[model samples]
Target: MAASGAAVLHRAVRANLTARALALVVVVLVLVISYATSLRIYFAQAHEIATTKAEIAQSQASIADLQSQITRWNDPAYVSAQARERLGWLVPGETGYTVVGADGKPLGGGLTLDSTPTDDPGQPQAMWWDRMWGSVKAADKPAVKKADPGKRAPVTPDSKPR
Candidate 1:
C-alpha cells in the first residue's frame, strides 16, 4: 500500500510539471506572435515614411528646376531669343528670309511654325465676313442625312407602296 501511494504521488507531480511546461510554451508562443506583428507593422510604416520622403525630395527638385526656368524667362535676351527661334520674329527694320524647299515647305534648323502654308498659294482665301456669312447660311439649313445603301427602309403595315 505504501509503494502504491508513492507511485500515485510521483505521477501527479509529473502531470503537474507537464501542465506547467505546456502553459509556459503557450505563453511564449503568444508573445512571439505579438512581437512579430508589431515588428511587421513598424517595418511597413518605416517603408511608407521613406517613400513619402523620397516623393517630397523629388517634388522639391522639380520646383527648383521650374524656379530656374522662371529666372531664365525673366531675362529679356532669353525672351528675344525664344521669340526669334520659336516664332521667327525679327527686330524692327531687319529683313527676314525663309528658305522654301521644292515641296513649298519652309526649310530651316529653327523651330517650325504650327501654321503651314496653303496647299495652293495662287488660291485666294475667302474674307472673314464672307466665311462668317457662309457659316450662317449653312447653320440656317437643316441637316440632311443620306440613307445607308446596305440597309432597307422600315415598312409599316398601314403604309401602301406607291
Candidate 2:
C-alpha cells in the first residue's frame, strides 16, 4: 500500500508539471505575436516619417528657388532686359531695327511685332478699326437656330387618344 501510494503521488506531480509547461508555452507565443505586431507598426511609422521629411525638403527647395526669382525680379536691370526681350520695348532715344531674312522672317533673336506689309499688292488691307467694326457688326447679328438631328420626337401609344 505504501508503494502504491508513492506511485500515485508521482503521477499527480507529472500531470501538474505538463499542464504548467503548456500554459507557459501558450503565454510566450501570445507575447511573441504581440511584439511582432508592434515592430511592424514601428517600422511603418518610421517609413512614413522619412517620406514626410523628403516632401518637406522638396517644398523648402522650391520656396528657396521662388525667393531667388523674386530677388532677381526686384532689380531694375533684370526687369528692363526682360521687357526688351519679351515685349520688344525700346529706350526713348534708342532706335530698334529688325534684320529680316529673304523669307520675310526676322533674323535676330529679339522679339519683333508683325509689322511686315502684305505680299498681295492688289488686295486692300483692312485697318485695326475696320476689323474691330466688322467684329462688332457680326456680334449684332442674331444667332441662327438649328434642330438637333439626334433628338427623337415624342411617341403616343396607339391604344390611347391621338
Please report, in order, the local distance difference test score of every candidate based on alpha carbons: 0.93, 0.90
Tens-digit lDDT string for candidate 1 (31-130): 9999999999999999999999999999999999999999999999999999998888999999999898999988877767577667577878888999
What TM-score, to 2 decimals, does candidate 2 have? 0.59
The regions of model 1 sitting more than 4 angstroms off are 1-6, 109-162
Assess every candidate by TM-score.
Answer: 0.63, 0.59
Q: Which candidate tops TM-score?
A: 1
